[model samples]
Target chain A: MDLLIQIIFGLLTALIIGAAMMVVTVRNIIHAALWLIASFFGVAALYLLLEAEFIAVVQVLVYIGAISILILFAIMLTRHISGEGERLLTRHWWAAAVVALGLFGAVLLPTLAGNAWGIPLPTGPAGTPEPLSGVEELGRGFVSEFLLHFEVAGVLLTVALIGAIVIAFEERSRRRRVLTLAEEHTLNQRQKASAERAAAAADMAD
Target chain B: MRDVIEQIINTTFGWGWPGWAISLIGYLIVAAILFLIAPFQMLFLTLFERRAIARMQDRVGPNRVGPEGAWQPLADGVKIFTKEDIVPDSADRWVHLIAPCVVVAPTMFMFAVVPWGPGMVPVDMNIGLLFFFAISSVSAVGLMMAGWASNNKFALIGAMRAVAQMVSYEIPAVLSLLSIVLITGSLSLVDLIAYQGGLFISSSDVAGVPDLGLGWFIFTPVGFLAFIAFFIAALAEGERTPFDIPEADSEIVAGYMTEYSGMKFGLFYLAQYVLNFLLCAITSVIFFGGWQGPGVGWLYAQAITPANPGGGWIFNVLAGALGVFYFLAKTYGFFFVMVWIRGAYPRLRIDQLMDFGWKFLIPLTLVNIFGATIWVALTKWGAAEGLAIVEGWSPMLRWAVAFVVTLALNLGAYLFLARIFAESQAERLRVDDEVLERLTNVA
Candidate 1:
């Protein structure tokens, strides 16, 4: 059973990491968004395996629900310019890849050395293992122990609210001003045309 | 029976068939169920809704199906299936094909988390609530896909409105639940229910005769307001009645479903009802104290007989079955209410819906959470202080105060929402006027 879990975890981790990379590296922004969703799903599955039900759900909610759609909408709005061409890679692709590779090696080489690296593994998984009872224990901890952090999250949300309002209001105003100006321009043109018609009628009468 | 036969096969063969083999079996099972039971359920629900709404409207409905319209949905299904599977020449073939799948799959996946009974669930994930939210949200992507893929102007516009509505509403939905989770402290649906077992009810001491009351999350005021918040969110999520702007049949001509047909269209239609059912079920579980009953233990005990003396398993099964029935009944009740509202209320404009979600639901939910947390903490403190005196009075008083506060806030929120809705509608009218003028000039 342990071995089965291990294999599943290993496969999941690889898939998750690969998908994470693909999200950034993919040429098509839409495809990239889809890849990011795959990565999020992979992470959610990992959270499930770890028995972090709430976190997993939050991950899926934020990433897939809010973030992915936001990205999709952004992509759609910008589609006229970017089109379908997967031009996600910046000018320094090789540099980025080399840096990534170096960072991977730095972590992987020592990890491959295993015991020689001298990092201690506890009798159980490091950090507070998520309670098997799920939300009940998590709730208790959140309310009593991490109450501070939980409250901070509320503050963060407030900030988000303020930011959303500002942006929305700004956008609304900009659209309104432009629309009013355009209306005025059209009205002016129509008036000019009528005046010209009146002058032509007078000429005909004369 | 066939179920016994399948059980034998499953036990004997085990679940370790090759991935493809297992998947093939699962697929076949799902397809069979969908092909067989889905149509029946869809038909029944349709008839049920029609009859229910008709009663609400004080009229007899669908009495011709099969002695009071029993077979109406079946006839409807048959008609839909035999209808031509029209594909617009201008539509993108692949995306169009996949759109219904996207819409349908998420709704279907939501059932996996719902506990119909102890072992009756398909996939009992710990993050079941989250899973439901995640999967349901993806339906918007499907809507967008359907809209974009169709290449029809109406479909595209409808899809945009849908995507916007869903995205805006999603936050308030999560935030509303976040408040509940704060009090309950767990994400597991089972755990959430368990927390509510005792807290769901209190003895009302009217003349010293302890009145055993309804066990529900909505009993408390914050819980009650939260229930309303959750209900509105669920309604919008399911695209019911006032919130059913996505498929505003009168306006967009089936909205994003403009180009879909055949089995694919069937999938989307099935998903719509399934999602509707799920939103109701989920609401029941979260706010109505799922599976809690009076003398549930006694009910289980009564299930055991002389022939089944050591039938602890039987009792377990009975209890689970009872829970399933209760859950389903509550869900159906909610669905009936939704249908009733649909028959009664006018559809909301897209801007109105968004304003309701963001300007109203979001702010109210946040305030509800703030008030709830403080209220819970204060009540707990009171219980601690008046440990001896507050023993009998604790649940009742706590609940009463919570109930009053929640009701007040809900009313306030509604008024606030009305104002916002009015303002946004006026703004939208202004925009519409500009657009109309431009169109007239261009013409």
Candidate 2:
């Protein structure tokens, strides 16, 4: 049973890592986003295997739902650069392939050889065990054991939110300057054209 | 339940090699069978939703496939498979290709945690309920990926809104479940069901009964409120009507799935229907008594005992079969309710949705939890003090109380709305008549 679990976990992890790598390597931004999602799913499954169900759900909700969509929105807004063209990347394909293969070989060898040095496996059950780490358990644990860290995380979130607002305000001022500059140039051009037309009319009358 | 499966398999096939290997093989075989049937089940669910909604709207839906368009999904599947797979010229190629796969995988993974029948679950963990929540939430990522990868502005916007909506609504869903968890004092889905039984009566009383029947969670007022919240949240989770702004057909043209075609599109469609089934199943387990029918326990014992003359693989198979049927019925009933609502109501605006979740649902659910906890605490304290506050009530009286409470609440709600809107009683009555006429097919 342990071996089977190990194998399943190993396979799932490999899929996740491979997908994550593909997300960066793939030419298409959309495809890269998709692969990243696959990686998130791999991590979620790992969380389930570890019986950290709440964390797994949180991982999915935050990373997959929020981050991926934000990335997509950014991609959409940058319409001029987002379009696909053949050969966006230019690299020595053979050398890159060889390096990738060599890296995989190096990692695989140690994983295969280090089997004997395995950590102590969970003895009770494959999934969640008795005195289950439920929401209530986590809640109690939060107030007792990890209260400081939880409070710090909350404080960090607030700081980040405030920083975002300040940055946004700065960006707003910068955008106003750029907009006024463009408006001034257009207005000057229009006035010059009108002056030229008036002078031509006077010369015709003379 | 999983232990029972291990024991049964070990006793019968103990002479084999390692017990673990045999169990692994057994589980894989079961998974294989379920995988084969899952697609068909998804297709049927779609048809059922379509037909039920059509009936609610007094229209005939998809009557061209097979008998009553039963084979429509199959035909649709074939069409999707044969269609051209478009790789958007401007889209992120890798993310686009991986998006549907991402969506499908989490949905499939969720099924692994769901128990449809007695001793039929693939994995019966102590954190089964948590497992369900975790796996179900992962689909949001897939959806987001799909939206992002599409490279369509509409898709991107829709995905963002959907993510926000799902995340906010998830709070109420979890809180509602938390209330139930408090009552049951367990996270395991099976244990929670057992606890509900133990709460209402003694073990001896249960033993005297046929299936060790429990008072269903829906019977209590607090439980009923939780059930409503769960149902609404689930509809939002599944991107169903009223909460389906993320995929509003007239506005966004299928939202995140806009750029998808061929089998890729089919996968998303398949996932949506399966998700509907999954949500219904979860609601049934959490809110309703799962597979808790009359004489079910007795039949289970009779089918499993060695001394019983008729006991064999056949009886065991029958038990499993019945279990599956009961589970399917419960899931379908919930799905039908969703379909009915979809036909009856209009979609909500995104802002309205966010407000509904954070403003109304969260506070309402918190109130429900407080009420349930106080009720439980009072009952326990009373028992300890030898003053019975609630022992038993006549069924008729209980039903009457329910009716009077509901009527009074409805009247209060109506009066409040009238006051707030500054509408006269005559105008309010007119609006009520119009709604009633619409419901009764007179308008």
Candidate 3:
């Protein structure tokens, strides 16, 4: 049973790492996003294995459902750059590789090698089994223990949303600027042609 | 079924087999059941949609293929199977291939938490509702992948519209369910259905009420509003007509499905109908008293089980049959409504869909949530539970007060939001006319 458990864990770990590698390596941006989703699913499965059903579902909901779709949306909305023969790597690829290796060595090596490595929650008596929590504990914690943090996070999200709106409306304000250009600028024949182009752009914006 | 499977496996194998092996067998059995049910559900839903829509359109739909055209979907399935599975030359081959699997998988996973009859859940998950919706959302990626991989402009557009519509509408749908969740204090669909086992007033709301199986959430004003919002959102989620901008046939040439052919297209069709069936089933479960109609509770109580092995197996079969009958009746009724709406209404534009979802439905559901809170306070809470005023009131009186308060709030919110939406739309059009007139005059 223990060996079987270990085998499942090893498989999930391999899946996660392999998928993550594919996410980075896939030349097609859409394919890369899909690979990233596989990584997310692997992480979610890991969470499920750890008895965090709520977190696992949330992970899938947010990452696979929303984030991955958003990435694909972004890929589609932008210029079609994911076709064959286009190099995915930058000129500083080797530098990135070296940095990644160094970072992994610096962070992962010590922690992985350390004795007291796992998450340290409040432990009960030596033989007493720990209780696994789901939505109930999380909800209670959000309302009671972590109430301020929860509210703060919510407020932060609201502010961020407002900030996004303001930034988006800033572009709308530019359309008004284009409308006012005719009143503000004095034009020669050459300048008039440029002004007409501006007018046409504004009209198109409308 | 899972528990039964486990018991059977354990009994046959004696004590030698470990718990995990039994559990694995149980899981496989449950998964197999769900997987099997999904395709059949898809088949029936497709045939049902066609026939139902045909009747709505005043046509005798598909009377040829075996007994009121029950075998129509089967025939269609065979045809789809035989057809050549075509991938566009420009398509990203792998994503195109895997998209159908990804799309189909979530709908299958959703069946895990869906209680078909009493003690008939594949997995009675604690956070079943959340798990179901979250799993459902994962399919958006599949839809997007299909669109993007197709390398067709129409497909991409369709995919974008579908994803946006789904994500936007999910807020109202989820928010509407929040009130129910708060009311019941449980996200389990089984528990939710179990809560509604009494006459008019739920057993959860008023203890000792006879389980007439009439206490549906839709009977309450808050739940009614939530039901309205949820059904609309469900329509959007299922991509039924009026919210079917994702695959508006005339506009985008079959939308994201333009490039897909044969079994690949068939897979999408299967996924869609199955999804619609689940949505309708869930709606009935959450809002209507699913599998909780007359005689079900009593039969279930007398049925053979771990608690009462001496109880007759006769009651078990009777209970199962009656429960499933009621559940399917309610579910099919909702599906008929979907078909009715599809026949009645034309598809909305993408912008209109967004506006309906974000502007109207979201605010309505949000206010309904507030009303739901108020309802919870009046119906559930007392001085003991921290609401001091409603302490000494009778359950009936409290229920009445909750009904009045929530009704007023929800009705007022609906009117106000409708006014606001109308005014904003009118205002935008007015400004557009003014701007247009000014531009034309200047030219």
Considering every candidate listed, which one attains the maximal DockQ? 3
Candidate 1 clashing pairs, residues 3+ apart or interchain: A27-A86, A135-B185, A135-B186, A135-B187, A136-B186, A139-B185, B221-B402, B221-B403
Q: Among all windows of ten consecutive residues in candidate 1 chain A, which has the lowest summed lDDT?
A: A171-180
Best candidate per TM-score, number?
3
Give per-residue CA lDDT, model 2, range A1-206, as digits (tens): 78878998999989898998898678777667667777887987898788777777677767765676566556655656754776655568778778989999988997888765577666756674564636777878887899999999999999987997786465422343222344456556656776788899999999
Question: Tens-digit lDDT track for model 3 on A1-206?
Answer: 87987898999999999999998987777777888999999999999888778889899888877778777777776655556686779889999999999998888877888844576665656864765566788888999999999999999989987996786464432465233343334223335666788899999999
Interface RMSD, one decimal, each candidate: 5.8, 16.0, 7.3
**Interface DockQ of each model:** 0.31, 0.17, 0.36
Top lDDT prediction, candidate number: 3
Clashes of each: 8, 14, 0
Q: Is the docking of candidate 3 incorrect, acceptable, medium or high quality?
A: acceptable
Candidate fnat values, all: 0.44, 0.36, 0.69
Fraction of native Cα-Cα interface contacts (under 8 Å, chains A and B) also present in model 1? 0.44
- Candidate 2's residue-wise lDDT over B136-237, tens digit each? 666676677778778798887777777777777888898888877766667777765544442233222133322354556776666777898889999998
Residue B130 Cα positional deviation in candidate 1, in Å, after optimal superposition: 3.5
Using lDDT as the measure, name the better of candidate 1 and candidate 2. Answer: 1
Chain B TM (all candidates) = 0.79, 0.80, 0.96
